[model samples]
Target: MSLMITDECINCDVCEPECPNGAISQGEEIYVIDPNLCTECVGHFDEPQCQQVCPVDCIPLDPGHEESREQLYAKYERIMAVEE
Candidate 1:
């Protein structure tokens, strides 16, 4: 599943750089995760780097954008292919 930054986010600016997928960005209010680009670090890391660095724990799996591990991995591959 893709991760989301909730309203509880402190805007500490830590999660943005930690996202290997470049999914996290500064929203009008809080940080937002682009579901299209989010892979939860499936092909890059074992765990979501943004979640690890987030102090407020505001980042959570987005139920609305639920995806299986295989799907995430596929998305990661697609992203990598585009970059290459």
Candidate 2:
């Protein structure tokens, strides 16, 4: 599943650069994770980079956009394909 930044995000700018899929971006109020591009770092890393570096612990799996590990890898592949 994709990860989301909660309202607790301090905009420390840490998560933005950590996202390998480039899914995290600066929103009007805080950082926003794009579900379409988010694969929880499946194809890129063992763990979600954003979550690893988040100081506020605001990043969490989005239950609303739930998906299995296989599904997340598929999304990662699709995103990589588009980039290539």
Candidate 3:
């Protein structure tokens, strides 16, 4: 599943760089996660780097964009392919 930044986010900007997928960005109010790009750090790291760096624990799984691990890996592969 993709991760989401909640209203509880402090806008610390720590999470943005930690996201290997480049899914986190500054939103109008709080940091936002693009579900289409988020991969929960699959194919890059064993765990979500954003969540690890988030001090407030505001990042959570986006239930609305639920996806399996295989799907997340596929997304990662697609992203890597595009970059290449």
User: What lDDT would each prediction earn against the true structure?
Assistant: 0.94, 0.92, 0.93
Per-residue lDDT of candidate 2, residues 8-69 (tens digit): 99999998888888899999999999999999999899999889998889998899999999
For each of the candidates, give the backbone clash count.
0, 0, 0
Residue lDDT tens for model 3, 3-82:
99999999998999988878988999999999999999999999999989999998889999999999999999999999
Off by over 4 Å in 1: none
Error of 1 at 30 (Å): 0.5
Write down the TM-score of every candidate: 0.98, 0.97, 0.98
Q: How should the candidates be ordered by lDDT, best one leading?
A: 1, 3, 2
* Candidate 2: clashing pairs of residues: none
Candidate 2: list runs displaced more than 4 Å. Answer: none
Model 1 poorest ten-residue lDDT run = 15-24
**Model 2 poorest 10 in a row by lDDT:** 14-23
Q: In angstroms, what RMSD does candidate 2 have relative to the true structure?
A: 0.6
